[model samples]
Target: MTPPIDHAPTTEARMLEIVFPDHTNHLGTLFGGTALAWMDKAAFIAASRYSRRTVVTARSEQVDFKLPIKQGQLVETIARVVEVGRTSMQVEVELIAEDLLSGDRELCTRGRFVMIALDSRGRPAQVQALPGSAS
Candidate 1:
């Protein structure tokens, strides 16, 4: 039997990481490049799950690092597919930092990633359109 179809546009992906020494900069805070890598991974997972196909990051937009996440903190990344085009998905990703001891949490970074689905031959492939979307 065929699998069920998901028409909803609420597909999301979440991930958690510990800010170890390797993931931090000399200032004892999470490195910007490491944070972006984690966010991109979240976006990739979200887009792949939503499209049920292989997806690649096309671009990232408006990445704002509002707070410095200190080393030894916990980081939570949440990614959701906010829009869908003929062969692409716009995934919004946010990173939240939490103090392991006090349980304090704050939004540290946010960005939008564009992912494109690819076929077996590495060409852009059409994906299911979002509800009410013209694609």
Candidate 2:
């Protein structure tokens, strides 16, 4: 039998209107590096919410740019924690570009980020399991 879909409450974090200038790009659109930076920031928020401690990116599964974001568009990023390991968490981040006048929104990029919790001394730290998170 197929497993039930997880409808657990996802902690949503949003960043709005974080401008990216044209100089930070090789193409006219937003640079891939800039997208990655935003992804990291979003993932950090998700991971810290789940782990309740500082966390760092351990890996990026894949980042795919579905659409381009222009320099003048308003960018909004949302992150959600999807899974957790002993000391690591997986976060899904989606970047959307919104037109201020028309209120149109388009998904610009998406990726899964793996983050590991860190202690005060910067060592790997254990993260408490959320209810219904056990495998």
Model 1 lDDT per residue over 1-135, tens place: 999996544479999999999998899999999999999999999999999999999999999999999999999999999999889999999999999999999999999999999999999999898877665
Model 2, total clashes:
0
Per-candidate TM-score against the hidden true structure: 0.90, 0.84
Off by over 4 Å in 1: 1-10, 132-135
- Show the lowest summed lDDT stretch of 10 residues, model 2: 17-26
Q: What TM-score would you give candidate 1 relative to the actual structure?
A: 0.90
In the range 1-135, model 2's lDDT, one tens digit per residue, is: 999996534455677754567525756678888788888998998888778899999999988999988877888998888888889888999999998889999998999999999999999999877667765
Error of 2 at 103 (Å): 0.6
Off by over 4 Å in 2: 1-10, 18-27
Best by lDDT: 1
Look at candidate 2 and tell me the lDDT of residue 35: 83
lDDT against true structure, model 1: 0.94
